[model samples]
Target chain A: MTTDRAHSLKQLRRMLLVRRFEEKCAEVYQQQKIRGFLHLYIGEEAVAVGALAALRDDDAVVTTYREHGHALVRGISPDAVMAEMYGRATGCARGRGGSMHLFGAAQRFFGGYAIVGGGLPIAVGLALAEQMQATKRLVACFFGDGATEEGEYHESLNLASLWRLPVLFLCENNFYAMGTALARHAAVPDLCAIPRAHGIVSESVDGMDVVAVERAARAAADAIRETGKPRFLELQTYRFRAHSMYDADRYRDKAEIAEWKKRDPIELFVARLKAASVATDEDVAAIEREVSGEVERAALAADAAPLEPISDLERDVLAKVVP
Target chain B: MTRTTYREGIRTALRTALHDDPRVFLMGEDVGKYGGAYACSLGLLEDFGPERVRDTPLCESTFVGAGIGAALGGMRPIVEIMTVNFSLLALDQIVNNAATLRHMSAGQFAVPLVVRMATGAGRQLAAQHSHSLENWYAHVPGIKVLASGTVQDAHDFVLEALADPDPVIVFEHQYLYAMEGELELGPARASPWRASVRRAGADLSVITYGGSLPKALAAAEALEAEGIRAEVVDLRSLRPLDDETILASVRKTHRALIVDEGWRTGSLSGELATRIMEGAFYDLDGPIARVCSAEVPIPYAKHLEDEALPRVETIVARAKELVARRG
Candidate 1:
């Protein structure tokens, strides 16, 4: 296969993996295995798979609680991610940070900040560090449309722009801040305008399409690299699952949900691959099997992983005193 | 040895830290150009240049949170929050991010950030600008909270706090900024974790910190004139309360009077009183008494403000009463 074909195939495989992993998480949550505020990125897989594909290895990523997809794509081992959900010793955060706090320092994945708009300032700071160090590295900060209403969002944008820090503000506009629609929470639902008001370059993209997200992210990342300034991209997408396991999801209409499902990212991407002759039917079937197998193995490994010792409960609260 | 004002001591400490460590930088609103709201970072901006001394926008949360991020990225950052009242704007970043990041990240990162903010009421800065809220910060777990009561502590604790690999909050009492004292500053004379007995006595223990330290000492002196010797214990570190020093003092005096500027309701004084009750109940000759600010919002009127806050007269009176009640 050609290089482009291989890359497209890889994207398809990643999206499938995220979808299948989240499906397994949902299943196990009911089985009493994975617990505590599981936010599945079922419909928003394309944004993570696409945007992360544009980042360099040394570049940093700070994301929100709905960050399993971001973590997986940022090269964190799926087994470690799964183990973290199980609260095991081998987890990314050593079982201390459950679903909403996954961290992989080696990969420069800062955290899965549960607080809305909390990660924005941290991203600006990370970018400031790189700028001060005269490094070309940039930081990608991911938050929801709901975060636009937060003061940190505005503050972060202003600081990033004023300092000319290299940062990509990826606003994943899933249209709901946990059942409160954007219109109800924000004066202006067009999040792209919010960053523009802060004097940062801003744009909105079809977040459901992986190729579009990748293109927009690469352009934004490149612009930040060239100018050492911040850029904002509003990824317009939807969430297929309930906000968390506990949500009754009574806030939205079923008709709206069904309409969004018609443009399901994974299904649309598979059709695009086939139409473009990037992958045949047999190839697609093979990719599905591989992704399913990987998810199964990860689940099994997480289940077998050891629990952190109770005696070490106080570990990592403070940095260990170097003797 | 040089005599320095509390403000000068803080400025000297910042200068020393900047000169000592290449990784250290100062960022805050008006820190660089305006020379700091409390003038603690004056002249250093011109000395170090703009890159090391950054002047940020008037957005507290983002700037404070940025300090945390910069620390995580391997730079020692000293973020000034103007005053405790303004620090509230950044409380989310301080309490949620800086304090919790190390633990939440499971040791993947340590925020070596020092946040300096002027605290307490005395200049009649009104309800918005004045209030003692160090207790709120001390209530946190991950971050270390230090109250600089003297010129020596103001000069030294900044260095010690910067050396630590955790987030540390240094509360500079706004009232004590102009107070001058001789400091033999080279290395810090004491750890920021332990409490120091400012004055030693056997009759009563006057426990206090920050802006109340002088009042506590004055009360001790007044008691000395009255033939009642009172020990003055300055609680330099608020978070890890030096239970040893406190218990030792209580054991010696058999009477304790906590003088705190923070209000009586859910104050650090209350916590200290509880600690004394729990550990040295048998050692106590009388019930533990406390002179804290009134529960009402700190009024702007000087007399009302004086009444609201713990005064030297109140401290002396409370001490005398406690001593008399010691049976």
Candidate 2:
């Protein structure tokens, strides 16, 4: 709906932010500044950035553990997300939610759920609430390719379609469900077709291409917001990093990894911008420098932030700043 | 005070909650068209239609997880697990997802979700369906546990739980459904977090909740004939144990006995005894006691099932022992 320049620039900023933030996270994890399973969204930035760009600020989002990218794209400050990864009190969840559970209520980012296929039903529920209240807000749910194997995913799709709730199921088909390749796990290699079984409108697009992802996501998000019906989008992508910090480089062949790495979403987007004369090489480098600066500043702030005291451990267990 | 069965009281609460809030809805196996496995949602499907009154696939873990998700997503979701026995299939979602979401999110999210299920023994239901596992749910943090023992509680607890900003589990006794009584569906208010004094006495404090509540009340009525006054404390909320209520009663009676329908070993009774030892040990004049289910699987036969669960006679005997030993 918006102009092509605005969309391209927003996508550039988001993709760069995710890449830089996660690269910093990887470095921090090595330095022990961050702990827990840090699943980086290094090569899969287009799915979160492109899809989230299609959503409004009031619209909610639910995602899986690989969610640093989702949080950044959904408008959570880099400082808060970085501090959360550092387990600092200034973090988004006041440092209680680490890498796997980043939550930003202000932005309507429901959570970064760690449980596989866990965010699906939640998105459906949120959509149900919106539909019941007659609100125009839509719920965007992001999960991995592996989540389709989970019963919650199927159940959520059926419930959403059955109720005609306004929700978008965005499956980040990164070709793996935590080291289990989609080919090995899924009977049908195509994940989008699965939603059709639930009577949901489904589409698959190349996740490495930002414009394609944004176009498809915008169309799907608009349909859900206007019609109060669920839509599914499968973004075929791949992860350049391991499943977690403990994962060794043993899941797939190096060439396959290299093959997918060549289609790097961020790099291709930057190249496309150069070819189309939308932005110069200097402009792309300047954007990279800007993201690196933001990541460094966030890391510094997080390093300076205080660790949550043990006394307040029992606090915030039952109640939150109620909406 | 309008008269209603325990089943009808719960239904009224559901009807009221659904009518009051647009966010509140029900989901579980047979909760919609089939009218629920236990008939708790008998007419909700007709009144609310399939949108508000939803029937889920037999995927307990996913549906329960979805309820947690739905709550996190700003909806008040009430999930029914046919019975407490079947809830085990979704225990991981309950314990790991629902119970830990708020704390794990560092207060970013508070799951206003309620999970309802039938519990305790009595019906000729076999071992799988007859076990009372409130103690297991109570053991977890980040979740509030409730047991509805009266018609008022059956109606009041669901509304209160729905109002809470945290996850709550309501254990509805299967046998209590048929029991009839007046149900005044009152406005939602915080029923004090502490235990309630069902019947006051001076000899021994009898702490019980849910299925054992009626048996304790009956035991109290019978114990009155024996000249031993037993103070019956109904523990409505189990997790955030109204320790003050139990401790004050223990101080008044100087002796205590916990009546629980759960098994003897590692039960809620065990936790109550430990709490008494820690909080009211100095105030106690005698040893703490408990009359829990026998340490065995609940048999299918009606007679054996009655023997395995805590009955009025058994609670009376346990209370008499505590009173007699009040040296």
Best model per lDDT: 1
Mind giving the per-residue lDDT tens digits that candidate 1 earns over B1-327?
Answer: 898899999999999999998889999999998999999999998999999999999899999999988887778999998999999999999888888888777899899999999999988888988899999999998888899899999988888889988899999999999999988877637887889999999998899999999999988898899999999999999977889999999999999999999988898988999999999999999898999988888889999888888899999899889998947
Alpha-carbon error at B10 in model 1, in Å?
A: 0.5
True contacts kept of each: 0.65, 0.62
Q: Name the lDDT value of residue A91 in candidate 2.
A: 93
Per-residue lDDT of model 2, residues B1-327, tens digit only: 888899989999999999998888999999999998778899998998887898887878768877886777668989999899999988878887788878877776788899999998899897999999999999998888899899888888888889888889998999999888877756644473557999999989999998888889999999999999999999998878888889999989989999999988998999999999999888898889889898888999888888888889888888888888846
Q: Write the per-residue lDDT of candidate 1 for residues A239-316, one digit (tens) a residue.
A: 998999999999999999999999999899888878877789999899999989999999999999999999998888
User: TM-scores for chain A, candidates in order?
Assistant: 0.98, 0.97
DockQ of each model against the real complex?
0.63, 0.44
Q: Write the per-residue lDDT of candidate 2 for residues A63-152, one digit (tens) a residue.
A: 998899999988899999999999999999987789989888899988888878767777877787787678999999999888998877
Stretches of candidate 2 above 4 Å error?
A1-3, A320-323, B45-50, B185-192
- The CA lDDT at B118 in model 1 is 93
Return the lDDT, model 1, position B131.
95
The local distance difference test score of model 1 is: 0.91
CA-lDDT, candidates in order: 0.91, 0.87
